[model samples]
Target chain A: MIITSKKAIMFVLSKIEGAVLMAKRGMLIVLSGPSGVGKGTVRKALFEDPEVDFNYSISMTTRNPREGEKNGVDYYFVSKEQFEENIKNGEMLEYAKYVDNYYGTPLNYVNEQLNAGHDVFLEVEVNGALQVRANCPDGVFIFLTPPDIKELRSRLVGRGTDDLEVINKRIQKASKEIRMMQNYDYAIVNDKIKNAVEQIKDIVKSERLKVNRVMPDYLDSLGDEI
Target chain B: MIITSKKAIMFVLSKIEGAVLMAKRGMLIVLSGPSGVGKGTVRKALFEDPEVDFNYSISMTTRNPREGEKNGVDYYFVSKEQFEENIKNGEMLEYAKYVDNYYGTPLNYVNEQLNAGHDVFLEVEVNGALQVRANCPDGVFIFLTPPDIKELRSRLVGRGTDDLEVINKRIQKASKEIRMMQNYDYAIVNDKIKNAVEQIKDIVKSERLKVNRVMPDYLDSLGDEI
Candidate 1:
């Protein structure tokens, strides 16, 4: 009778192990592109779509929040001193300073969410994305690109605020960023926001089903069953 | 004048090279699974769906053609002697002798289709798929799996034609085949045909966008443009 009960407990524990194996750690999907490539627009559309499910990582910033922006929602408002301290402690996954204000992703929040089996989405600039890659090499780095150089130049020029010299400089900067796409895992052409979102959705689905990501846990669960 | 014309011709050639680079070679997608895992059902559903675009590779067989089965449509019916000759000459990608009849995939046909930038799809038995993997290591090998061991046992018994002894034998064979799924690139659970089909569609889309597959050609097309 003792042996029977012990066997029963072992069977139950094995079943629980199988359940744990099925709940895989979530992926970090980084969306980045050159200036004027509409990365933000596509990301916003993706979040708004009901079919797209991901936890958006709100960035921590030292800049004063604009009107209608709430703390912890739009951004985690932090002081420059606190931000610098976090950076010193290696709490920032990626960060950048603009006009004397610091903007950064918090490593603690991303790790917490990912450990809980929730995918975290990050929208960042090209250089900032490279920094994130350095920190988290396994993150899915998707580089969004314009339909063509002509379209990219026109989009930059369409702002109608910059002079011809400024426009040319911006175009050159964009070209340099486009070249950085070779470092990414996937390059998506941002021709249509909906199409780009769909491609990204497919990418996430496929990534989840990847053998390397899921097989180790599965093999562990099998554990001599074969 | 000669230098000007020569430069113009070089420009045209470069554009053609870019076009050629854009047309990447197609992939070989092999779908295999244990018996009673419903691989055939999922493949049929995938092909029936309009969104799934792939050229199905018609197998060559020496078996007698059934009624209403047209040559080159269902399969390329060939004589046993010709099939053996092709096999001896290494023209077969994968082959098997079942019930005294030869069945195989023609390497030339698969290569012709793939080189023409058409994705080729092949459905084969587990052992036959292993043979294909040996011949084409780069193929996208997807293993369809039953949801669980109970479901697999029931599926084998559900045929209703086999007695308990035969059913047990089939279950044992299936367990061995299931172990082979570790060799595959992706293992999709066959819970629902529609869901499996959707996953496969995502896999194809994501595979097409893989960096390793498309990057070399894209870099060549850039040709120092960056």
Candidate 2:
């Protein structure tokens, strides 16, 4: 009995010690939202949140970015042929064509950030997010939408750049986009920007603690000590 | 182009309106830990926390109540025959015998609270927890361990009711329990009581937002408006 007690004590000590040495894997957070949902503003606020560490995934686009866009920072500018080759090699998480330009997530960069223990955030369109969903089902998929259609309409009208006709068109597209929330891992109603950012941050904290992410090596060390 | 945009807008509007009427299901949170880990203290703090809504699962036991213990509050005290009948009826989520006492969780109470939209918290042994795990895979399983084995030993010794031999026995059982933390959904190092409560509260917030929990009725209601 005494010997058994000693063995148990040693076993407990090893688990605590082993946990301290084990590295944590980063979470893959994929976000999608309709226009006027303030993705840019929310991303900025998330970056500033004190408790979170985020690594934004830069997409590779075949289309030239408008003014003030820098290559490799705003996006990794690549040729159409190169993009096609990546598609063939299964190197893209998700890709879509809009107005004759190609935009998609490069798997290598995302994998690198995740492997290096940095939470990678990718804000993509609905269709693109779905593709990423297929590739990384474990990834946290968050959908941001307005509280109601009236609020959405108000935001679109408030944008000022779009005319009444154009604003109407955008709102209609947004309605269709909102339905995709069912496919997301989480849906945040962006009624208040600060609350929305905090909600996402809270999600990051919880995902980091999932049991599936527990290190096998650390668990094995417990038995070794016994 | 105009017609397509209008149709898309109507489709989106209907989906959002549908979502407004759907009711959300409650979460099932299963918690387990080693002895002297302060489960009682943490549960008390969690109950008082303003942001969380918890329904603590009342366990059933075939043991006589100690001084000041009340039926239906501390435990649902039942006869050994009654407890065996419950086991025969498959009404228990988990049950185990210890020192001539039978203790376990009753599934009916847990399910009633869950269906009523209250997050239920269950504190059970590691083996009991695994039984619940098989019965309810969607349940969130959390484990609480001490900051170190030394602190655990000190707590067990400080109880004063147990002698060295009893304390040693308790510690030995605790080591086996600590190893079971590997199977838990999240493990909290309970160095401080308040922090443990907050961690659990954060977990509740995150779990409520999972995509699988979104209300289909609410999603359908949005389309009704269109």
- TM-score list, all predictions: 0.82, 0.72
Residue range B1-226, candidate 1, lDDT tens digits? 5455445435644674657656678899999888778987888898899987898888899998999988998789999999999999999999999889988899998999888889999988888899999988988999997664445444544555655556556555655665677889888888889999999999999888776676655454434433
Chain A superposition TM-score per model: 0.83, 0.75
Q: Count the backbone clashes (under 3 Å) in each candidate.
A: 0, 15
Report the poorest 10 consecutive residues by lDDT, candidate 1 chain B. B217-226
Best by DockQ: 1
lDDT of 2 by residue, A71-130 (tens): 988899999999999999999989999888899999998998887777899988888888
* Per-residue lDDT of B217 in model 1: 55
| Candidate 1 lDDT score at position A188 | 87
Query: Model 1 compared with the native: what TM-score?
Result: 0.82
Report i-RMS for every model: 6.9, 5.9
Q: Which segments of model 2 are wrong by more than 4 Å?
A: A1-24, A34-36, A62-73, A76-93, A146-179, A223-226, B1-23, B34-37, B67-72, B77-92, B145-183, B215-217, B222-226
